[model samples]
Target: MNDGLNPAWLRAFVAVCDTGSFTRAAASLDLTQAAVSQQVQRLEAECGPLLIRRTRKASLTPAGVKVLAYARDMEEAHARLRLALADDDPHVGQISVASPGSIGLLLYPRLLALQAAHPGLSVSYRAAPTADIIAAVLASRAELGIVTHRPDDERLRTELFAHESLCLVVPAQMDDVSWPALVRLGYIDHPDGMDMGRRLLARVHPGQRIDQLPVRGFTNQIGAILDPVAHGIGFAVLPRFAVQAYPRRQAIRVVDTAPQVIDSLWLVTRAEWPLSASAAWALERLREHDWLAGADAPASWPAHDNG
Candidate 1:
């Protein structure tokens, strides 16, 4: 007699086991509850009773206990097989990446180039804040995330992607670098300004409080923060990536300070989920980018340690 084993039956069995609820398994697999039940019944017929019923739940029978191990192994093999097939045509898959608006601005050109190089590949990049990027990666909405800070979560695997130096930016015409001149210029505060603000305060006036510093302007948008500074309204401190690409870069320049401030960029992905072939390829490309080498920028930004 034929074993009559089927991948769908195995998938349904594993989904139910993983979810612990047939209803939840059905919803997760996008299959009808009746359909999932039928699939499980088919598997049970093939391998004897697989699940033992309990109040509000189910447990694996001895047979299911054995079958689950084999089912997972089979799923891994299937995933590898799909990956192998995808490798033959790396240009035919999709990968999603999430980054903050500043990083997105710096990465967009490279993303366009990636798509151009592989016409069949689809790339989706979302501009979100660090918190939102982490949430997107955890939710499986995004396969990769790049951000300035890493969270202390065991579920995330982080690597040092790059180091971006912070710079005090003033109107291009502002030539004075004295403390009095800076105090007169005041600070253009934004949502991301707090960290830079604190660092700037420590460097500008040691032992002085942040509230003691003059606040000239305020905004929530990163891109908008630079415009006022460029027009001689007030000065703001920002990451090199955010400032270097501004269309009006010629209008503002980095102010050399006694102690330099730097922000390290981290690449993060969920530790539990294996990357798909396309995502892995994209990640490799990103890893190979020249920025990771950190040669062009001045020595103000130090290399990151361990991740």
Candidate 2:
């Protein structure tokens, strides 16, 4: 309710509630006891109410409790901003990106190589599912998010990060021929990745019999899906990046198919903000790795996916 917001006073107020003593709160804030008391008084006067009960254990009044919650949220936001600021390097600014587990492991090492070149450039990483990564970018919680595939939201600025061949991996012991027969063998599918596989299925073998699809064996972990495939519980689908090595003594084999198809990886970000220097470096490093794999490099970032 105060027209002149006192962020410092809010800090002091929360400190008092946490430490349960004004003297301790003043020490924490490096302010004198009288100054802490004065700030509390001013905050209360502005809000037309008392915030804390002055007793052995400091506690919030009904009004103080409400303000305290808001203060905590504000403090958290400020803390994030401070971290971002601290990441600044003379050559590049700090960037925070959210990505999926598989791609992040495969991709972030590429950025680490760039650290030698762009000493000032730095990157922070967070892991989440595709939908969660999109949400993070939308809320401006991260500068960018590297998702396995493009998000459903049309507003996101997305660019093709990479496209590597993918295959339907099944226990080597279970051999099958053609697309029609593969589905009948029961697949341990990933629910989050079902959409991409849906596209593949639609193209390769439209309307194949899925009666044996094994919807019961579903998981979000790529490794779990692979486990079933390895032990021959059912076939699993995974990107080539997840495979690490071919065959690897696992009783798994790529389904017999021609003209292999691959899943697309996308780097998504807000359309409005200029790409931070650190993020731009990371994006370029990702592109460099893609090119290393004999794929075309991205012409530019901050691109949109019409699909």
Candidate 3:
């Protein structure tokens, strides 16, 4: 009859074969026996004789056996399609996010915990600078991004997600963070070190530029930026989250400043498309942290140990 098999006809045929009786199949399908018989006849019209023995008991021909397997496969595929379309479960999908190294240091563990809690969920976290994060979101490489500043692009929607304080870190043995003291210690610079240093140091050391400090060492790695500082080589400025994650944190001291210098962290996404269920779920989970609420005060340094 037609170019394609009618799903209704195949369903009725499969039901009849499974039940082994027309009356039982009709009851299972919630159809009259006459209606079920008509559907079976329609299937036979499309593919030639299917049922050779149709009495109180039904028997399948060779062609009917082959069609039955394919019909069952189609039913299974249809069920999977319905499940995929009804993607209401937020805890069972993939999410991709990009952020600066400092933010990543704080977020990666949380996302890992989320994935651990929901084994069906998967997370892809990329540690990148502001520019790279923007690029990744634009290119569709990442669905979510975290940046210190709100992006100016019309394509991106940004919301203030958190406030990250810039920290001036010195060696554990150091006590005084006077301008002259910092000058003697020099500056351990990283990619964002000079900028962060200038922003935070500007308040304390008025009229002094960050470049005025000698550059004792340089590292692009967020974790290693504090290494030289921890070893008593020089001082550096870093995000509080990055400072908190250092393995040798006790070796370095975070200098508490009056009128703390803080950077607004923005969550970014494409303006055109709404976030998927998984990404939205992840965003909510990330917002649950107290630090993300911008309530974190400057951390007090541990007492200096001369020994």
Candidate 4:
């Protein structure tokens, strides 16, 4: 028997069985009677003789009965595939997103809330570094990505999503932000700690480099980076969102600096592909909140460059 049986042949064979005659089946299928008969003949040629009687009314042999069942199953499966492909409803599908740990802390809950409100929607969130976030978006693993810096790839579309201030988190007891005070407090490093410290500290401690400070502790976990600081172990530089979400908010203080070091957060997606309805809806929801509202920025502060 032929393995690659044509669907049209199966459709015609099933229609003949339904109408009980090739002439009536041809009328229902909008084809000539000879064409319908030829289709059924082609089906039988592929699957062996399927009809035992060729009278005004059709009769199915045992083989024909089995073929009819298989054809019906194939038709139902094709219908289901069509329905799935046609489902473009924004509220009825999954949306995957990835971002840095600081933003993920804020975003994951918001997405969960969205899922709660719309029970039909499902969410997948990932806390990742900038490079990993970009890779996820490019590989189509994530429909949306939040990165501290804009990606340079031509395949990606990036827009300024929000601004995150680099904050100096010190023990709540420490009021002094003087260079000597920070040096005496030492440093608690994380994945982005050294780079963020260099940027923010450069403004406050003009001549001092981050390496000059002794490393008291290190943790790559965003939530736990401030644990040592809370215990009065050392100071660390972190994004304002991460600092705000910390459970022990009273144990740490964000030191007020002369000029705040703000990092631009970019929303990235595939440039060539249109976003799914659910992904677009989620993106809009994410943009609704001012992520920096209570981060201690001056009302008159102008937006900084992407640098």
lDDT of each: 0.79, 0.67, 0.84, 0.86
lDDT of each residue in 208-229, candidate 3, tens digit only? 8998999999998887888899
**Residues 1-307 of candidate 2: C-alpha lDDT, one tens digit per residue:** 6565599888888888888889999999999989998888888877656454656867777888888888899998898687566655335656678876666656566656666677766667787878888888989878888777667676688887665555667777776645655656666778544654554455556676444365537787654567767776776656656654333545677764443455566888888766765677566656654333632223442222324
User: 1-307 in candidate 1: lDDT tens per residue?
Assistant: 1464888999999999999989999999999999999999998888999999787888999999998998999988888678656665556667789987776776767776788998867888898888899999999888899977877889898887777766788899999966678778888988778777677657756776566558889987767889988888888888777776688888887777656556677889999967777778877776687754431335654543323
Model 3 CA lDDT for position 141: 93
Clashes of each: 0, 2, 0, 0
In model 4, residue pairs whose N, Cα or C atoms come closer than 3 Å (at least 3 residues apart or on different chains), thus clashing, are none
TM-score of 2: 0.55
List candidate 1 segments past 4 Å from native.
1-88, 292-307
Structural similarity to truth (TM-score) of each candidate: 0.65, 0.55, 0.69, 0.73
Q: lDDT score, residue 125, model 1?
A: 87
Candidate 4 error regions (>4 Å): 1-84, 290-292, 295-307
List where candidate 2 sits over 4 angstroms from the true fold: 1-94, 108-123, 148-156, 178-185, 193-198, 201-207, 244-251, 259-262, 290-306
186 in model 2: Cα distance from truth in Å? 2.4
lDDT of 3 at 266: 82
- Write out the backbone clash pairs for model 3: none
Q: What is model 2's C-alpha RMSD?
A: 8.3
In candidate 4, what residue range of length 10 has the lowest lDDT sum?
296-305
